[model samples]
Target chain A: AQSVTQPDIHITVSEGASLELRCNYSYGATPYLFWYVQSPGQGLQLLLKYFSGDTLVQGIKGFEAEFKRSQSSFNLRKPSVHWSDAAEYFCAVGVWGGSQGNLIFGKGTKLSVKP
Target chain B: DVKVTQSSRYLVKRTGEKVFLECVQDMDHENMFWYRQDPGLGLRLIYFSYDVKMKEKGDIPEGYSVSREKKERFSLILESASTNQTSMYLCASSLNLVQGETQYFGPGTRLLVL
Candidate 1:
């Protein structure tokens, strides 16, 4: 069984400041990771995903995540945070095989951006 | 753009009543999934279907059942609605796992059990 852990429950950042959200996963094989964001009263949107190849994957809204196999982490980062970036972020892991190879998500980290 | 549509945006159902949540995708995705979102719990998968008439239980599938009669539509059924089931239900569609496609989510249906 695979699981994801997001260390931060909530993070507050000022506008134009840099942001980083930590995510770690526990899996046996090469893991497939993803980041998703959700606004209030809305569904989730995929921020980015990492399957293989490049260690760094770029996503929508100027967000990027680096997959580190040694650390078992895929942390989301943005150089400058915007007010619109304030939302709940989730980290997920998916297995490659099986019929119901759906994603297992973290508890989520609420991001607050202050202007 | 791929669109996954849920039948209702907000639903209020009485306890012990049977509840049905419908989801449809236009992208011809082979995989459809049902998930629930709580306050702190991110998203818990209830059920999923890889193809028509084929359904599989996810991590938390005790209180929920699903039906996929057609390729594009997946329905989540709650045999008897409970207060604990009062949460946001989301539907997602994706290509098969071998394709490594990302799941596209619906707008979500918020269910309140009274």
Candidate 2:
């Protein structure tokens, strides 16, 4: 079965600090990975995606993710954290062939920014 | 922008009552999916529809039924709502599996069964 793991359930960082949320996926072949952000009581918003090509992929809100095949991980990173960036982050893996666009999401990591 | 809208933001229903959650997408997407979101558990697919009147069971299809009579609308039905079914329900749409791998999501509907 395909699965996504987000190791940190909750992570707190100071404002203006750097942020990196770990994500690993369980899949056989080359995988399509994505990162999403969700605010309280709101749906998820796409952060970044890694389909193919360069290991590093950039997304909206000044977010980026890197796909590393050897580790089977696609981690999301941001240069500087902002108060507005505090939210729950999800890492998802996109299926191919049968359910090409279907996604398997991680439990999520809640990020709290300190003032 | 591709917009996916849910019928309600929050719903409260009594146990044994029939529940219907509606979803609509404006992008004329070919695939529509329904998922349940839990705290510890990630989003679990309940059901999906590829076309009008066509549906498929997802990972967690038990205790739920779906109807897709129209192209852009998909509805999830619970024959008898139960207390354990209280959770947030999310709807998503995509053009297709291969062409559109990224799915657009709706705000979600929080269902609380009493």
Candidate 3:
């Protein structure tokens, strides 16, 4: 079974400040990791996904994540966050080539950006 | 654009009433899924359909049923709606499982059961 854990429940950051959201996963083999963002009353939007290759993956809205196999982590980062970047973020993991490719998601981290 | 559309953006139903949530995707994907979103819980899968009439239970399938008569449309049904079932329902679709595919989500339906 695959599972994801996000340590931070909520994080507040000032406009133009760098932000990092930690995510850890428990899977047997090399897993596919993804980051998703959701606004209030809206569905989730994929930020980026990691299958293989480059450890540093860039996503939409100037967000990036590094896949660290040693720590079983795929942490999302942004150089400078804007006020509009305030939303809930989720980390998900899935098996490499499983039949039922369903994702197991973390609890989610709510981001608050202050201007 | 791969668009996934959910029939209702907001729904209100009474307890014990039957509720249906419709989802349609234009991408001709082979996999479709229904999930519920809550405050602490990010997104819990309710049901998934790999093909027409081929449904599978997800982590949380109790009190929920699904129908997929056609390839593009997937429906989630609540036999007896309860107050605990009130949540945002999300629909997603993806390509076949052979390739590394990412699921695209719909706008979601907020169901309020009272």
Instruction: Give the candidate number with the greatest DockQ.
Output: 2
Model 2: colliding residue pairs = none
Across B1-114, the per-residue lDDT of candidate 2 in tens digits comes to 999999999999999999999999999899999999999897899998888999989989999999999999999999999999999999999888663288889999999999
Between candidates 1 and 2, the TM-score winner: 2
**lDDT (Cα, tens digit) per residue for candidate 1, span B57-89:** 887999889999999999999999999999999
Model 2, runs deviating above 4 Å = A97-101
Off by over 4 Å in 3: A96-98
Query: Per-model TM-score of chain A alone?
Result: 0.96, 0.95, 0.96
Candidate number that wins on lDDT, 1 or 2 = 1
lDDT tens readout by residue for model 3, B1-114:
899999999999999999999999999999999999998988998998999999999889999999999999999999999999999999999997533468899999999999
DockQ of every model listed? 0.60, 0.62, 0.59
Model 3 Cα lDDT, one tens digit per residue, A24-76: 99998778999999988888899999999999999999999999999999999
lDDT of 1 by residue, A1-115 (tens): 6789999999999999999999999999878899999988889999999999999999999999999999999999999999999999999988755544668899999999999
The predicted structure with the larger DockQ, 1 or 3, is: 1
* Of 2 and 3, the candidate ranking higher by DockQ: 2
TM-score of each: 0.96, 0.97, 0.97
Q: Distance (Å) between predicted and true CA of A11, model 1? A: 0.7
Model 1 reproduced share of reference interface contacts: 0.51
